[model samples]
Target: MMENIIRLNFTKGKKTILQGQLNWSNRSADSIVGISGISGSGKTSLLRVLAGLEPEVKHHFRFNNICYSDYQAADKNIGVVFQHAHLFPHINVIENLKLALKAAHHKAKRGQANQVTSHKFELEQVIDGLAISDLLDKSVEQLSGGQKQRVAIARALLCQPCLLFLDEALSAIDKENRLEILTWLKTVNREHQLPMFFISHDSFDLQALADEIISVNDGKLISIQPIELSALSMGGGLNRAILNVQFDHHIQEHHINAYRLIEADSLKPNNGVLIYAKGVKAQSAITRILVACDQVAISTEANFNSSMINHIECKIVSILPLDETNQSVEMSIKGSASQMLYAQLSNYSIQRLDLAIGSRVWALFKLSASIAI
Candidate 1:
């Protein structure tokens, strides 16, 4: 059976700053939808509206075929983490996590023994996954910026939210720790199947993490494009060009000795192609192929029922949450050929198939799904 997922269509903001209808849908169970724009472009405002942190003048938000009012959204099991780790200075890390858990429990129906045990297990899992079991005994004020941010994330996860929103959650940490935390967050999302919506000004982060990017201008959604890695032609030459391509995280510099150029039928940017390349190896030649993450699917077994042509047994290298609101999964898959491919699937699928790091899976994609760069 197909799930209705989430469908949102609405407008917000009275002034010209943010006054346009935004239509979005999450067909999958998990997604990471990214919103990017210049500062003051109302990126944060849109997130606040969706998360019920800010009021919307006009809005329609629906999830799983159920329409939710603003009040309902406000009470929804949604977790949010901001740029700063706003932990209670007077409290210790464990206390903060316990407080969040208690609050979540308090609002729910009377907990049974099994439910309580389940919650306790989940809490322990989150604490350990975030690697904050040791830090739990430390005071919030005594922790470093990175430690505090991890605790904040752990607190949010302890609530067992249906949706998680991160508004520059890693910005407070130093560059090295920020990246480490990001990797940990990916692992958490994969194992927990928690959907997330992340806001960032860093193009690299968005490109590396997001499945679908939402570009906003003046509070209006200007473009929604899949994040595809492209091999750009670097050197200039009349007959040949040097193409810098990245595959399996390794840069393979290709000199296009001879190739035919085929312009795309449609007038879309980044829609042209090199018909053929002679000098590059056959396996590495497809490095110029731009594969949309969403077009590729992952499964525990080979999809014999489907007609998708490109099927490769792959190892799950990493799984990152693309958009939590949609419950999307962005995974880095390494084929036996040492080629790296990105596949996007739902959190439901990940959970159903029991996919995890180092798990062997089949990456399925159609030949037509790949576009020449």
Candidate 2:
């Protein structure tokens, strides 16, 4: 059954920095919703209004069919994770997690005396699910920047709110850690089917985790677009624009052209395999690589002395089917250490290879072959 998603319609007092009429609504209950705007665009202010942290200032917001600002039934179920870890320096991870659970129980109107035992068990379960079992007893000071953030996220999730709001949550993290945390966030969302509302100016954040992007400028939302998080990570900009990689199947070439280059960071080690050209013309020679997945061929081993200069030894890590016709495949090459290359192939090839987990294969790239999308 479809669930009730929050509808947030609010406006903050006009700040000289960002002055515009603000009214937007989110209809998705189980999807990741993102609000992106430039610095001082009132993104954080809008988030606070929705979260009910700030006193309602002549606005409307409803969650689970309940009015958040209404004098009656003003309380609403919500969880928030900010950019900083925000954990108490004296408290350990488990205690922090317990605090969230306690808050949730209180919000649910459960008696404090009851459910104490069950709450402990639930807290342990959340900690384990977030992969922080090793950090359960550790104080906040002992945790790394990434680990603390994970704890904070875990704390938020433990609240079991219908809506989770993240405010530029990964802004302080390093690039590598940010990616890892994003991947974990997706997994958590998928596993639990919890909806998220994220606020950020970083396109990479939107690309990595957001399913739908809502752009805001001068405190006003301009447009909303669908964005696949995986597409952002597959050779897309880590901090800049998230570019999706494409390979063309119709064209075939033995020799590679100058524009046929892989992502710069991807070429660093074992991190990238998807080839992409930045800031180039549409008719560029590398454009041939933009073919549909059905046209390309997959091989267990590279064809010796073959004309295909794009042959690279790869390890198949995942096979994600895009509907009935196409598949998005994840592969790791020999040299890249922290990155994975993604390729779009056909379901026919997946069945043909009887591909299973941990399969080794060679992704044949006819220098001219390309993916259309």
Candidate 3:
């Protein structure tokens, strides 16, 4: 029954918000874990319990070989970013940051220096990374919702936590800033080997960041699985395909970092497709990918002059109407090993390209859409 790599028997509440065991054995140290659930489903409650805020609930818990008592969990130097920014109203932004640094330093001075397992993050680096330099002089009360979130994020990173927990922390920020911070988070996680548990209601955040996602319902863990776009409950979301993917690690080419999409492990070696993505790393052993079907463009021949990276050779299998007016159609194509993928194109472009059911063509997608998750 305890087959999971880290078994969890948590009783977060008396009536039990989470009265179940977590079966997560495939998790890696550097993997970003996502917690997803509805608004009142105890997402934050679970996080609070794990961070030692709800120590009473954790008394009955024993996780794998390690059992964190209230003191250990509370004093483990875990960093957390809450949904609502919890900045001190009496202090300015810089003062708030200084207070956090001071606390971390005091924790270190308490003869617990060995607890700092992750990389030591510098204050200036975190400020610049989160783009919070301008707001340092302003009081916490004067900042907007997004600005406060940025500073809160900065404060958490400055602590140099071994484990980080984000409880819908990015929900208040705009899309652009959220993406920027998420990218930085991934970079820091890889460089310093920081394991993170990010909680968000947005599937896009989970898809872009989480190596594996844990689903929750009625405050109970429903499942823990790898990133699958279909498993994300993206109904009426972007059209995509899950294909058996094999890629070589990221390498530099003409001053650009990219990954080479190789054929399946069973296939012989050949010149592979090159894709540029921010999330690609050589250490990642990803074998499958979720391809945005809308981003896929079909062509009779490979066109490198255009910026599109993927040029997969496949045979057209079938075409199905997308709408009542038939302005567009969803086309299916088979690559090596009979792997099927989809592309949504307009009727005009299909005729313009002279694509046929059995004709061979190259599927083209941009460098940005090559997210392995």
Candidate 4:
């Protein structure tokens, strides 16, 4: 038997703001695909087209060998969470979700749609998954930016759509809440076998959720590849890596986490890495963290007494100049056991350390308030 897949072919204005060809396939029914590009480079245009929101382009959406001819035809199977939560302002949170549930039920009865790996969602489960159980009676106007997003996501779940499209859907939320919600979404994808198309300016968000990422550049599809930090092509963006970490506890309610990098290798010091973040919960199921290249510092010897908690022994793999005329350089440093992390330094610093390929050194990292995700 063949594996399941979703294929999309779309193009707009022979010389316009958007052109795209995206294909999603995997052995597992659940997969998250990412759309990324620089602003004005057609990222949103491509995403809107792929989601069938751009009706001017002829319909070209397929799932499991079944095709939907138009946006209306596709609406039944697709649920979109926009950048802003578009809930009915007059209704309270529960009312909004109930409305979605009722609409989905009506659609189910009328269309009698194919099962097609669809997941049935309960109101309780939706609210619980999004942690909106407490906000049921609150009106939409009373909710904060993050709370509104959670409600919006919960409403989408109630529709029981086979596919989900997230358009920078969680941008308004704080880092801690965002991570919590992302963790919950990962569970949703795995347990319900639901697929998602994710779009965000933040590469960390893409790495956190996407399985495959499609890069759009200057109004055309540039490339498609498996999701990784290196696959980020937003042009002149920071280099980053995502790591699984264990959260020991919050220190002094200062919103700092006693975090330890999990599976980082024997090179990582036993002391591990701690992060200074706001709104972090001890119970936060945060499994992945984004470490920026700028956050890492190179040292000839591990500094145990420094305020920076994370220190790892790594060998310099490669050093390249950002610009021949500029003194700044970037280094690819590898852990003793696996994978490379980056550090940015000046020419003077490189000369002082006399670092080179295969030269063992330490990479010090500090997680700031906004980097927990």
Candidate 5:
């Protein structure tokens, strides 16, 4: 079980939207937790309460394993982003980012003064990673819907908070922009290890990003489900098969050991593939990765002595970052059409290379270093 950053045990308002049964325990501190529920289900209200943005509501809240409130006030680090862009139309992009950092800085403890300065450095790095360096002076009114959202994301991250709340922040964007933002969000969550609370109504949106799907209706939380594959098997076999993957952890090589017998008719087809391996572990040679546009770092000059084993020369297509905290530098490699790889790097690196959206570089990684399947 995971320890949650916060929990709720009290009711809100006259409607009795949340009856006494809602509870989430064992939540990791730096997790990208998402909430999916229908409209008028109080998702926004829940976010407000957790963030301490709304104090009138009755509830119990905790921060970093310490109880904050059972209707009592407790100071906690929190950053929030609403559906709208919330950018000041008169302010420029970088100026907006600085404002967000200043606000978060005020929340820092008196003894932790150095943390505020360090956080400022991080904010600059985050802004650079966002790839809006050239647009720093561009006013908010000059930005498009997508661009505004990107700035908003950077502002949220610049806060350097322990917990973040996103209340359908992507709802106003177009489809292409929405997809692009989702990829960036995934990258940020993995790279920075920031825990978040994402509220949305779309199932497809949740499927592409959520570690656990929690459904809410009329203010009540339904059961949460995690996606998993049960087994892998072949067609027309009377007995079901279980793939036993064996690998050398030290050498980083993998092989199939054998298969176990089980009942047939348990398999189902999905999108063209029929078999699923849920809990089975593969040999060390194979790697499983949750893709992040930021993690795929590329360099124009390839080096032989570096630890990177997976190196591929690619043409730069587009480099995007939701905000300064998590940047996505996209590249188009040869022979792999429409396929791209990302390298997660700090804002400093993004500026050090003076990388443009279309510059050529070599994407590098250690094949053995990624998460093993």
Candidate 6:
């Protein structure tokens, strides 16, 4: 069992968000703790303070009964995964992972050849676990959103930190790959007893991944509660709905009959619903049902035999390049009801299909690919 106590305060401009004490303990439970709140609610600030990235007005942290000042605590094997991957654009995937290990070795007082070889072996294991062995030679500029996130996670793991802080680290990943990475993380946490602070806005993710949930609002600790699996039935008048709840340590099953409104435009208000469904059963509903723009496919014509369940007729509103490499572009489209959707397609595909602003296309995706919050 590990014990941690945190007392910190931060002030910006004329407003002070954190005022008093915030404590946490994992005496008899899992190490991962979930922090959730809306934007500007001090979630990221809390992580920054803990990571020693932000100077605290006053702070004290105790890990495993060892007392240390804020700056001193930052030196303790602490690992962090920010929202953005932030990989070096000039380096390859393997080089990025090895950079941290090499730095740590150079800083050590004793660096033996055997120790260096052992670190290299550990790096191999980490890359293999992440399923990125094939991506070792690929430059960061060539990687997609999901791939970059995976490399970032692998790099963090290689640091071998006792405490880890993840701020929406899995936000950019696709549903399938995200689950796979999460499973690997669970194993690592259990075997190594590594404590982690996870921050996300998804309620279902908190319920599924966290043993204890820490709620924060306006920079104040709101509540701390144990996660319990229970069936919640939401009833309505116009639409008939059925929610089949299944809860275990590993998986959460949710079935809901609800209407999904796709936003078409950011600058203008939408007056009508784009697509309405009578029933929807997402394989895993632990995360918010948001499909990444890159996961969606756009075509000039719809295919009836395709496995994708959701297909909306939309008109391309704009096309924006995503990176300097010109490998991918974000295409924004508007549905009949003024709801907007985005799809990431290759520049080659865009040119091949003759897709441009005002072009009619169909946005296609499978129900399984949608992320549930």
Task: Say which candidate scores most in lDDT.
Answer: 4
Better of 1 and 6 by lDDT: 6
lDDT of 5 by residue, 263-293 (tens): 1123221121111222234433212233333
Candidate 3 Cα deviation (angstroms), residue 330: 11
Best candidate (score: TM-score): 4
Total backbone collisions, model 3: 1
Could you estimate the TM-score for every candidate?
A: 0.55, 0.55, 0.73, 0.76, 0.55, 0.57
lDDT score of residue 290 within candidate 4: 69
- Cα lDDT of model 4 overall? 0.68
Q: Clashing pairs in model 3?
A: 5-25
- Each candidate: RMSD: 16.6, 15.1, 5.9, 5.0, 17.8, 15.6
Q: Please tell me which model should have the higher TM-score, number 4 or number 5.
A: 4
lDDT at residue 122 of model 5 (Cα atoms) = 73
In candidate 4, what are the lDDT values of residues 168-224, reduced to their tens digit? 899999877887787778768877878887888877778777767778777777766
Clashes of 6: 11
Error of 2 at 69 (Å): 4.2
Of candidates 5 and 3, the better by lDDT: 3
Better of 4 and 5 by lDDT: 4
Q: Sort all candidates by lDDT, best to worst.
A: 4, 3, 6, 2, 1, 5
Q: What's model 2's lDDT at 233? A: 32
**Alpha-carbon lDDT, every model:** 0.56, 0.57, 0.67, 0.68, 0.54, 0.60
Q: Per-residue CA lDDT of candidate 1, range 305-355, in tens?
A: 876655656677767665662233333333122225666677778788888
